[model samples]
Target: MIAVNGRDTEWREGLTIRIIMQENKYTSPRIVIKVNGHVVRQEQWESYAVQDGDDVLVLHLIAGG
Candidate 1:
């Protein structure tokens, strides 16, 4: 199991940041993802693996006029 955005989620082998985004339906253009307090680069999202008991934080950046 893993903690995503303070919510418990099922853990799976070979799970990457990209997969997590898809699973949670996170499609914000300004979203930022960090695992264990380290930032995950956009290019590495597909390769950055998320392990069990990890704390994943997804921050959504917003702008207004």
Candidate 2:
């Protein structure tokens, strides 16, 4: 199982950060992603693998003038 934004979800095997972003319809690299309390780099998304019981946090980027 994987926890996303405080909700538990079934583990999706072979799910990479990239795939997760795609599944969630997020294409912007500006979004922040944290897996198991660690920030995942943009280039590492394709290689960062998510496992069962992992906590994934997806945060949107906020900008201000």
Candidate 3:
């Protein structure tokens, strides 16, 4: 199991950042993903693999005037 935005989510092998986002229906264009306290590069989302018991934080960036 893994903690995604404070909620417990099922963990599986070969799970990448992209897969996690897809599974959680996270489609925000300006999304920031952090795993185990480490920031994951946007370009690496498709290939960044998260492990079991990992804490994943997904935040949507907002811009205001």
What lDDT would candidate 1 get against the real structure? 0.92
Evaluate all candidate structures by whole-model CA lDDT and list the values in order: 0.92, 0.86, 0.91
What is the Cα-based lDDT of residue 35 in candidate 3? 91
Candidate 1 per-residue lDDT over residues 1-65, each given as its tens digit:
99999999999999999999998899876888899999988889889999999999999988987
TM-scores of the candidates are 0.92, 0.86, 0.92
Let me know the TM-score candidate 3 reaches against the reference structure: 0.92
State the number of backbone clashes in model 2. 0
In the range 1-65, model 2's lDDT, one tens digit per residue, is 89888987778788898888887798876788999889988889898889989999999887886
Best candidate (score: lDDT): 1
TM value for model 2: 0.86
List candidate 3 stretches off by more than 4 Å. Answer: none
Regions of model 1 farther than 4 Å from truth: none
Identify the superior model by lDDT, candidate 1 or candidate 3: 1
